[model samples]
Target: MENTKSRKQPSTVFAVVSFIAIVAVLIIMINLGVNTTLSVFAGVIMAVIVTALLGIPWKETEKNIISVAADCMPTFLIVIMVGMLVGIWMASGTVPSLMYYGMQIISPKILVPLAFVLCGLTSEFTGTSFGSVATMGLAMVGIASTTSIPIPLVVGAIVSGAWLGDKMSPLSDTTNLASGVSKVGLYDHIHSMMYTTLPAGIVALILFTIAGLHYGGNMDTAQQQLIMNTLADNFHISLILILPCILVILISVFRLPSLLGMGLAVVISTIFGLVFQGVGFVQLMDYAFNGFSIKTGVAIVDPMLNRGGVLSMSELLVTFMIASVMGAIITTSGILDVLAKNVLLKFIKNKSILVLVTLIYCYIVNFLTAGGQTVAIIVTEQTFETTYKDMNISRRVLSRTLEDAGTLSAPIVPWGVATIYVMGVLGCSNAYIPYAWFIFIVPIFSMVCAITGIGMWDADEKPLRTKKA
Candidate 1:
């Protein structure tokens, strides 16, 4: 304790300056066309400088950086596992089968809700919201043209469903990133989010049904049927292909290690590919590492299926490592501690306000960076991490809240990266933004849970303010 007292804490202004400098470097580097890993590394360098200014020695900081990296090793492995699982599952005909069957759910009465479900399932299956938008979303928008339903509403359902699955799916880089940042088990993080996500999903579906039922007549399903036929022609589609996904879910449900589950699924999927798809072992291994590729001769279907590999998700290795350094530096140099004690603890009177501020900051970062969900999640998670601990709130809350605002808010921002891509793919406009109900609905549930203490499980010390009785 005497040795601890010898170290000086950074002042509030210094802490604030350190944070701003890191964020500025990140934003500038990204805008200048730097890759995400390098941008985060730049921010990490800024943090190292701040730590030096705080009078911490270089050796100690280096150790802290390595320790942070080491701590993240499991999550890193899980991310790779997720990627491999996706690739092999695709090769084994799992993903294609899901897509083919999901397309069968569309009917005139529930066209809007079907679009949302189909997009959500596609994204969840393949773990690519952008792909889902380009494929399912494109088809949904095309079919809507033959109906009286508003284009914006169909686009909104597509956007909401795509983002919702991206936010929740284990295969998503963003989801795993959130899990790693908050230091929770991958499945634990996903399960925790269901508190907010499940209800929001239900509400969004109800609204879509109500809005779409009046206009759900005489719609053409030509594009949908074409895509299904393309999938059928390319691969043997079957319900048995769903076992891989079910295996992952059972792993989550039974509280098994995610790595074991993912690895097991990869092995099982490899066997399935051999037995059912007649894919060779060496070729399957190649797909596992490099991702699956196929020429279905369809514009959207090809892009959607040409995804998932260890290399595809390897970019996170550097990004997560560097982002961990940023978190460790600010934490070790007492930057976040100072900021929290002097500022956050003062303004954030209770858990409700704390949760609200986190949600807003996530949105702000996403908006300012024009859809840097990785930046938004990692930065906000680091900034609020220790504060959540101090307030006796779980860090899981921080992860879930960031996802609610960061991931969901991405496509809704008219000029954001996600929205731009969606527009380019579907030829839709900002008219879809207002109808993206899941984005709007989830945050409301997050706030309500904050106020009511519904999902706000206790951590350690009692909070300054208690939840409503």
Candidate 2:
């Protein structure tokens, strides 16, 4: 873990070949329809070969790997904590109450835009699109299914809202990751993203509103009302069920570590489960491990509420481990160093070109990697960190652009994990791609800002004008 930097940099040929090999393994395995964790594991294997080819000893490389992967222990802990929080929230009827009350006031007239807003708020507080999808998104999709509104369009709005909030939320893994990798302040990274994200959010809201008006709420609501009634009868629906959510917002406002915040919040939610839901400590522990399960007699609500638990994130945890190993190998072998300095840097000409190239790389990686934002952000930020510094560009710009391209690209790509997850949860297809307003809008805003030099800050975070020429 100490100064293992004494290893020689891999030659250009070795570096390029190694990089391409790992990328090929990822793209091929992913496209071949293999499990995502397996695909990433293959990439890790390819990484091991790359290190061996470069004559880096396994001992030194292993140490380097552990050193790098250890940095993510906190992130991993946060993920587990989020899982526990989700499970406890469900058991405590917190999520159920939100869905219940949400369905209470939802005017079908504005359901489209309201779905977007509700998903956004849910994702904002929960810090995971998966969490929002499991709770609010499922509820919205259930209501939409009971209506004449297009399911694909509603799913699109839901995806937009989920990712929009995720990109901005401080507790989001991807958001924190982009900032961490680029060495930007978390708040500063979120602030810098406003340039692209703000416009995109507004445009998405307006588009959804127009669609809502066009749809016009012409639906039979007896079933929707029945579902709401079912929720009311089963779960304890009260204003106090929302304390867990309030705790999350307070944690964010206080700018505490997500792992610590989520840990404390999970405890509070566990108490709520015991006090409000009449769950025993052992039963709560079971829920913590295997997720909450309840038979509400409503087909939709049961599945939606059945989603959280530490074990539920097994695939995601494995993917993180694989990503960490692959990333560590790339760093330890020094190939990334050679490629960035000798190859990538040679092509970077100016601010606009740099931003464009970065964005393209991110999107391509995102699509090829099946929409894992962590890998995309890591590779792009590491590849360009020196280039940005050399060009006097702020790292915050890197963080912002990473989200605009990488995070946003996830839900839009048909083969992406995020897109597939959304489709599965919403019981829809790739048809939602055309309607993910916010995800698509940010890229346009990003490109325009790059060309116009708007929001392009210098290394000092000072406003600067870039010559488009």
**Quick one: best TM-score, which candidate?**
2
lDDT of each: 0.75, 0.77
Cα TM-score of candidate 2: 0.79
> Which digits, one per residue and each the tens of the lDDT, describe model 1 over residues 326-366?
65665577765565557665778778999988887777566
Worst 10-residue lDDT window for candidate 2 reads 1-10
As for candidate 1, its clashing pairs are none
Q: After superposition, how far is residue 293 of candidate 1 from its true place, in Å?
A: 1.9
> TM-score for all predictions?
0.66, 0.79
Q: Could you give candidate 2's per-residue lDDT for residues 305-368 as a string of tens digits?
A: 7767877766667676666676677667777557656776677778887887788778756654
Query: Largest lDDT belongs to which candidate?
Result: 2
